[model samples]
Target: MKTRLFRMGLAVLSLAAGFTLAGVVGPAMAQQNVTLALPAQSLLFAPAYIAAERGYFREAGIEPKIVYVAGPGVLTAVLGKSADFAMISGGIQIAAAVRNQKLVAIANTQDRFTTDIVVRKPVADKLGAVPPGDALARIRALKGLTIGIDAVNGLPHSFLRYLARKAGMNPETDFTITALQPQAMVAAMKSGTIEAMAFSPPFSLTAVNDGGALWITGPDVDLPEMKTFPYNVVLVRPDYCQAEAAACRGFTTAIGKAVALMRSDPAASLAALGKTFDRMEPEALRQSFAIFAKYTRTDLGLTEDMYRNAVAFDRAGGVIPETAAVPPASELYAPSLGR
Candidate 1:
């Protein structure tokens, strides 16, 4: 019995020594690589920019690569395995969910209604100036007014419809929504080509500062039903999550730390963001940060009310198939591995 016990102790010590030697000699063996795709126009993604710049991912044993794509294309890139994960709007996720897309929201990035409607100063003057509570009435009063929108069927458009309905006007009949890129919206607004637009900051900020006036801000027209209206969320494909569960969890932990850092010190976060978006002015960046700070929840948890509202919007609008089953929020959102 003594001889057998001695042999087992020797074997255990040898295995421990081997593991210690491997740890000392090959630290990189435990590290992971992850790629995240983000939309070009989101200030909400500032936390992600901070994570990449600040080496938080490195600290968490991950090497992260960030790719810029249009909001609509992010999910497809992840679904196709071209990217490991993506940051996308909750509305898009809900729409995709109705189609039975195999994507799960791992973090709740930004939830606030950040989109706004800006009208030319002259138009605002004609409509009786800035605090236009009856702005939809004024907007409806104008026949054939063109409003710029990023897409015909996305958040901007959906929210615009919601605002019009709140203001007691028909969006389809009252105004013409012109599809324009965010940058182009600024140029169009400046040139007086498009009288009004549904815009996201810094585009909205740019318009207001450059002489456009706010007709309506998104939150003012409350769509209480829309919960988990995620402006941007971190998503991983099911197959990728199943294959690399540990790596995905590590990435989430790193990202959660980044989000906390950003929320705690936005000025520092903007400095990090400056590395990627060089043209972003310090003031604009600060303003952008402030706007996003109000609505983004760094907790990485999706709200059920928000998800249901988004799902309803997509379903009612036929963005998602009528026959599709909307997954419960729990099934759609993964718990924050970071916490």
Candidate 2:
């Protein structure tokens, strides 16, 4: 009887040991640490902010550290390995992918071109007060003026080209586009160096209120080409994704929850955003978030039409060679991590 009892005890102990070894029940593991790269620390990326401040990242066992890159330089963060994931514009992402930069978009950001076209007071005066609703007329007024952009071939520049084309003017021949950093852009407009600029808020707000510029937000106008065009996106590197898929997935899932929070609770969303945009007034920030969020989707899903529009816009605007083949969704966005 003693020998039988001993054998049974040994079997039970061995089974318990096997369960622990197989990780069926054990002490919790350390949280996976990751760095997320953001193009700018603006309210334009509310979902990401929602995830971090709302404790979604922590809940998902991810110790997410945000690293900001200036000049909308998020893609470089991934290329340089400064971040595991990057939130940037799809235009930039598609252009980079065409250049063989290895990146996979995990989620889509804002579909509408959220940037506001701010025309200097002096510039608007020269056009003799066109109606606010007159998009084509305002676009026609853009001809023969010097416009400022963040970079030579960046979004502002590309948008100028697209707008010009839609309005039946050649951007290259009709208007002079110049590179002026945000700080310099304001100054240049004040000094009468550049007549107008396409910028995102709170800079857009500043241009209108402080600089006495006319704010013509793109979405308010009818622009078929820019509608539902993938602008901002969350992207990941394949190597890191394959290695830390669970963490990556957790990060993406957290953003989805953030989207819900932003939709359901504006006050909470703005409260969370206060830290990021410290100087921005609560009301102004709230208004801005409402305007941009109207087009933002929680899911990062991108259709072939989205991809096609981006590629066509870039190719048509001469951002890339017309001959460059646009990579499909499989090459451009990683299917596994976000899923």
lDDT by residue (1-339, candidate 1, tens digit) is 999999999999999999999888765445677778775656767777777798777767778788866656778888888888888778787777766676888777777677888888888777654345554565455446889988766677777766565556767887888888787888899899999888777778888887898777665544554445777778887556677877777777777777787778876777778876676666876787788777767777677777777776665545666577788887777755333
lDDT at residue 307 of model 2 (Cα atoms): 78
lDDT of 2 by residue, 120-238 (tens): 88667777877788677788888888887776656777777767776788888898887766657767777778888877776666666656565467777676556677787778876
| lDDT (Cα, 0-100) at 29 in candidate 2 | 51
| TM-score of candidate 1 to 2 decimals | 0.81
Q: How accurate is candidate 2 locally (lDDT)?
A: 0.76
Steric overlap count per candidate: 5, 2
- List lDDT for all candidates, in order: 0.74, 0.76
* Top model number, lDDT: 2
Candidate 2 stretches with Cα past 4 Å from truth are 1-29, 134-136, 168-193
What is the TM-score of candidate 2? 0.83
Index of the highest-TM-score prediction: 2
